[model samples]
Target: MNAFAPTRTSWRPRSLRWQVMAAVIAINLCAALAALVVIIANARRATEIEMLSSLAIGARFVQETVERIADEQGGTASLAQLPLHINGLRHVRIRIEDAQGNGIDLAPASHDEADGDADEVPDWFTALITVPPAERDIPVVENGRRIGEVRVAGEASDEIAEVWEDMTSLAVLALIVNIAILAALYLVLGRLLRPLKTLSQGLQELEEGRFDHRLPPPAFRELALLAERFNALGAALRLARDDNRRLNERLVQVQDDERRQIASELHDELGPCLFGLRANLESLERMTAYAPVASAAERVATMVDILDRIQGLNRRLLRRIRPMSLGHVPFAAVIADLVADFEAHSAGRRFDFVSEGLAEHYGDSIEITVFRCVQETVTNALRHGGARHISIELRHDAASGMLKMAVSDDGSGMRANALPGLGLIGIEERIGALGGRWHIGSTDPKGTRIDILIPLPPANVQAESAERTVIQ
Candidate 1:
């Protein structure tokens, strides 16, 4: 048998922890993005409204000043005397064009700081916070004809710089808040899910027949309910396991007792009776021979033949009921004996046995399960499949700790639609009891094969446990 080891693959299934964390982070990121969009949009709209209001109010003030100054006693000469621009401000550019077309310019600084101020923040942030510029014109007239024009537009370098600062601060604050919220969410989820980890480990151990793992009471309502349920489940399993162990023990005891009784009856009650009958027949045959009675002698020989046949039938029945020698012989040696016996009993029928990398030893339960499965399959093949030749192969995979045995017959093979009979069902139950599995192999003119695989525990764990056995 070639090594049937499975190749290891790289992809691993995601666990509950990572899945939950991913979902949490994904949801938080989406919420943060939505909030950011809304906040920036609202702030930008508010900035535009405020900038437009500043422009409107500044225009009204300029219009009122031009009208008031031109009406002064000095008239147009005094118009130049008025301070049209504020100190230390370069954003608001004030220009007055007189009726003579001469332009008067008033700016605290010559250079427009709004156009080329040192970049306060990144271009993207500045652009996001800036509002569209607004301009308004007011015509100044002394009486009826227009004297001069006062134009006002909002241009605040300090305002744009201040907006840039506010935006940067808002972004930093939002980032810190999002980080804090996500971090807290991560920690809270980890803490809340702590019980799940413990519960998972406990369930795994429970599945492996370790029923002692228990969960303590949790403070949270949902977790506490889950913990209580888990603990209860463990307790139920432990109770069921103990009960099953007792039942199995009693069943085993009864089976062993029946075997002993049958063996004793076959040996003590039937042995002497068959011996006496054989002795009586031998005496009669000798007496007939001495008397020269041919007919009598033939009858006596026929009687002796009948007696021998009965004894042979009895022994066969006993072997079928309980192969007590199976317990005494080596497991591998017993299989070799089975092949020899099958070939010896039937003419023109062959039984071939082969093994590959099989351990020289195993627990008694393993021995029993292997032997019974082979025996039943072989019987089914000969009796039902009309098999004349059978082949058996045994293998033990060290890496996987599994014992694999295959039994096949070169015969009519099994029908596809045929349901399993008593023997096959018995085989299935036997293997299941040992926590093993079996496969009914292919059909047709090819052959019939029955394969059984049993996982072997560590060498230290023997069949000493009461539950580690089969009744048959």
Candidate 2:
């Protein structure tokens, strides 16, 4: 019941191209993230493999030097010399321990060496190994017994750190590249789909019963063909619309003509007959005033009154079909007659008719249209609106060649959202037939108001027609 709410038609779309584009961007973004994840995992694996291989090579070299030094006689300095000889390595940490797990030397033997007990390696440094080394009991092999374990080790921390930094940098670069590519793709898609968007809007209009909208020619050949087909379809729909409108107009015109003809026949022919019969009956009643049977005369008088009532009903019916003639009557006279008729029929309800602005300079069709609009509006107000008072105003502007008529009532008015019924529909059709505008329904102060505006014929045209009529 709220006045601000619009009527819900069944033809509107819920989403447009912008929504689709956003969805596309989201899908592309997700795909880019997944691809980036896969690349980062592969890069990490490759880096780990390379680091492991490099460390293994360095460990073998250290082990060979340690075993060679052990082969020499009391050559503890040989294993210490291997640290400076291990070239092409950075931040290398080397450890040499004896059979009793006592450190012979540490490559990082300065104050910055990892904190540890005098003979044990730091827990953090040893934890870097993928697996812990096994312990042994025998000093030399005796029937499957082991002597000692030679541990040669290098740290993969720096290399792993370098690979992680490089991987992060590459991921950022890939994301920037993906974003630029997605933006370019989005623009290209938008440009290509622009014609489809226009076509969709046109179709939406057509679905809403606005069949006049035609799609513009598209850039693509196939789409251009589709646009042409749609244009042709719109043209055909317009033609159908015009045909239907003309058909309805013709039907209305025929009905109006039939009503006028019937009213004319009943009024000009049968009306007189009934009046003559009633007059003859009245004459009989008067002539038999002194009859011998007074009861018979009284019955004849009753029949005479009934005949007069029938004649009156027939006359009212004729007026209902077509108003009283205004052929030789001026505009004011016609309005006065109409107001008198309405007042008489309205059972004491007050009705007023007022006029202003060059009432003498009006056309027949304009005058009739205005009068009928007022008459019908007032009748409806009395019948359904429970109106106590009604006003009819007719105004003309001679300078502008505009004529306006308004009928207003203080009554139970119509709702703003309510549509026209049969009476209002007929009024609109008549006004349209005269090439005028018709407005109907409730006023702001709680009443029905029907305003009509019709353009008057140009003075030159009227003068030319008058000259022709004079020549004829």
Candidate 3:
């Protein structure tokens, strides 16, 4: 199975979405914490106030009842009667003091105590009397002189503790849930944006000389449209490139056509005139064979040599104008002809041709392309390869319909940075036109090789036979 299987939401960036959601949840959690703080603070204050109020009411009832009992007893209450009036109240703790010190009730008396020993009210009781309630104060007066006091205490309650605990637990749970939600969101967002990053990378690749890489469409509608546009632009650029290539080929073809016409005109007109002039000059030489100065014969001989040289130049020019026919010729025989021609033209080099399973006859264009490619290879080997020997090989496979041609030389081959020659360019163009592939490289130690392989054209046995008849 292919990795990155196509899907609708494949473009999502998983990590980024998690980050965004975490941020959102973090904000909510901060707000929640702040609100929880306020609620707890206020609740604590309310609980304290309620407890203090309840304590104050109990204190007030005790104090008023004690004052009423003291008045009914004419401002004197016996120690034994104290318990009767203070009975049934949760607040009452009695301490009766004489002029000297203090004495207490059911609770055990402190050590170092004397009866009626009233130095002053105790410090703890005094402090409780000094501090005021949040809303109001409770006053206890006897004979308009403050001797002792009762005050509210114990503000925290079990019910309020339970409520606060539950609130705390819920806040913590909310925090955990928020973190999970944010993590999920971040993952989703990261997945969404991943394809866009890949697309940007693809564009950079295209810019860096890799025209084949293509950007894919995004999952979402908006990004998908953008992807489609980019793909369309790439397609357009490829078409333009193809068009430019075709136009260049047409230009080369036109130039070749013009050269052919000029060479034909030269051959038809200038060549015959030069030949006729040479014949006339020869006849004149015969006529003046006995009645001529010494310089006349020498001049006639020089003219003949010059004419012969010109004729050779004309033949070379015509050969360049139009390539020689190798279509009807046996493939091996044509290779032999090319080698013989090259050997005759250049010294200090020998040529070799090899044929294995070559076709009886190929189309003119195929033969021409192969021949030109070989010719170019040999020319480069002599002119640039500094070669002592050149080798050409032609092979074909009937089953596979493949033709392979290679030219190698024993020479100082091309350097790494050497620019391709016009001939090499021509070979490449021709192979490209025929949808074939060609490569040039160092063959071995001190040598270059050019290799070409292409699918063979369908054989035309009848056409080959007719051409063989004509030739014969």
Q: Which stretches of candidate 3 lie over 4 Å from their true place?
A: 1-229, 232-308, 460-472
Clashes of each: 0, 0, 28
Clash-forming residue pairs, model 1: none
Per-residue CA lDDT of candidate 3, range 388-462, in tens? 888887777566776788889888988889887667877887899888998888875679888898777666322
Pairs of residues clashing in candidate 2: none
- Per lDDT, what order, best first? 1, 3, 2
lDDT of 2 by residue, 182-258 (tens): 68877877777888888888888888878889887877898899899988988888898897797688669868876
TM-score of each: 0.52, 0.44, 0.43
Write down the worst ten-residue block by lDDT for model 1. Answer: 463-472
Candidate 1 structure quality by residue, lDDT tens digits, 44-158:
7776776677777767667666656666643442435445432233345556667786777775355445555525556765677667777777776655667766666666444
lDDT of each: 0.70, 0.63, 0.64
| Model 1: lDDT of residue 352 | 80
Query: Of the candidates numbered 1 and 3, which has the greater TM-score value?
Result: 1
Query: Which candidate leads the pack in TM-score?
Result: 1
